[model samples]
Target: MSPRSGLQREVLSLYRRALRMVRTKPPSTRAKFLLFVRYSFHRNATTISPRQVSVIEHLMRQGRKQIEMYEDPSVKDCWVSKEMKEWNERT
Candidate 1:
C-alpha cells in the first residue's frame, strides 16, 4: 500500500515477496495478487507514462473476473520477465 521508500533493489525484492505471498494463499490470493499487479503498473505511474492502472484496479476489485486471461503463458512471462532478468529493466 505504501510507496516504496527504499532502494530499487529493495523495492523489487519487496514486490517479489508480496507476489509470492499472494500466489501461495487462498482467500487472500486474489486480493494480494491484484495489489501486486496494481503496484507494478503504478510503480512509475506518477513519473512515467499513463498505464491501465484503473482497469487493473477495477479487475482486482472484481474477483475472478477475466481470470481466464492468466491461462495464457505470455501474460505470465510478462509478469516475471523482470524477475527472470534480475534487473530493473522493463518487462
Candidate 2:
C-alpha cells in the first residue's frame, strides 16, 4: 500500500482503540482522553517506522493497564538513541 493509505489506516485504528476505551464499565474518560492525545501526537510524527508504531501502541495499551511490559531490557534498545539505527539493523 502507499504511504498515505498506510498512515490513514493507522490513524483510524488508533481512533477505534480510543473509542473502545469509552465503553469500559467504570468509564475511563480521562484515560481515553490521554490515549487520544498520545495517539494523535505520535500519529503526526513522520520520522517513526511502522514497526515503531506497533511497539508504541503496545506500550500505551499495556501501560494504561499498569502492566510492566517494558521490563525486558531489550525493549529500551528500541527507543531512539545514537545507536537506534544500528540496533534496528541487529534485530
State every prediction's TM-score relative to the real structure.
Answer: 0.32, 0.29
Write model 1 residue lDDT over 4-86, tens digit each, in one string.
43343443554454455456445523554555455554554444432555554453434233333443333432243435334
C-alpha lDDT of all candidate models, in order: 0.44, 0.45
Full-model lDDT, candidate 2: 0.45
Q: List model 2 lDDT by residue over 1-91, tens digit each.
A: 5556664565566555544443332342344334433444454455556567676666456544432222232322212333433433554
Candidate 1, residue 22: lDDT: 53
Model 2: pairs clashing at backbone N, Cα or C within 3 Å: none
**What is the lDDT, from 0 to 100, of the residue 50 in candidate 2?**
59
Worst 10 residues of 2 by lDDT: 70-79
- Please state the error at residue 33 of candidate 2 in Å: 3.4
